[model samples]
Target: MSSLQSVTDDTFDEVVLKSDLPVLVDFWADWCGPCKMLAPVLEQLAAEQEGKLTIVKLNADENQEIARRYDVMGLPTLNLYKNGEVVKQLVGAKPKRLIEKEIAEYL
Candidate 1:
């Protein structure tokens, strides 16, 4: 099973905003090819960074409210949240090393 947790519109605030550790929210859609490409990388990240970072996926199509609230304009948009606020945003598909480098400080 995938290590990544999925967040829905209903549980977004409680699961992500209220999280104790830094939360990496993957805003993606089922039809997005790049999002599919990044899934495995995120799964690896979720497993490797367990307890240090909370990585969750939010389907942009199914959860439009959260996506718009966060101003997600692209697929596979990675938003890092700390203290209930967005700290960093990464758009598009990227390699695991690059993704790790981008969110290294937060972790």
Candidate 2:
């Protein structure tokens, strides 16, 4: 089982936006290659960061409304939500180290 939680448009607000911990929302699609590449890295981070951060996956294809609301134009786009707002955005498949470094401050 993966540590990452799956969030749909219906649960998105309560799960990610209203989360107590910082939320890393991964916007991805089934056919996105880079999204597949980044999944394991995110899973690892979700496990390692446990209490410090909350990581969730949102299918951009299935939940196009939320994706468009957030202006996600690419696959594997990581949007860090803090206090119901996006604080940082990473728009590609990146190494775990790079991902960590990018969102370190927010974590």
Residues 1-107, model 1: lDDT tens digits: 35578999999999999999999999988899999999999998888999999999998999999999999999989999999999999999999999899999987
TM-score, candidate 1, is: 0.96
Scored by lDDT, model 2 comes in at: 0.93
| Model 2 segments more than 4 A misplaced | 1-3
Task: Write down the worst ten-residue block by lDDT for model 1.
Answer: 1-10
Position 8, candidate 2: lDDT? 95
- Native-referenced Cα lDDT, model 1: 0.93
Please, what's the RMSD in Å of model 1?
1.0
List where candidate 1 sits over 4 angstroms from the true fold: none
User: Model 2 over residues 1-107: C-alpha lDDT tens digits?
Assistant: 34578999899999998899999999998899999999999999998999999999999999998999999998989999999999999999999999999999988
Clashes of each: 0, 0
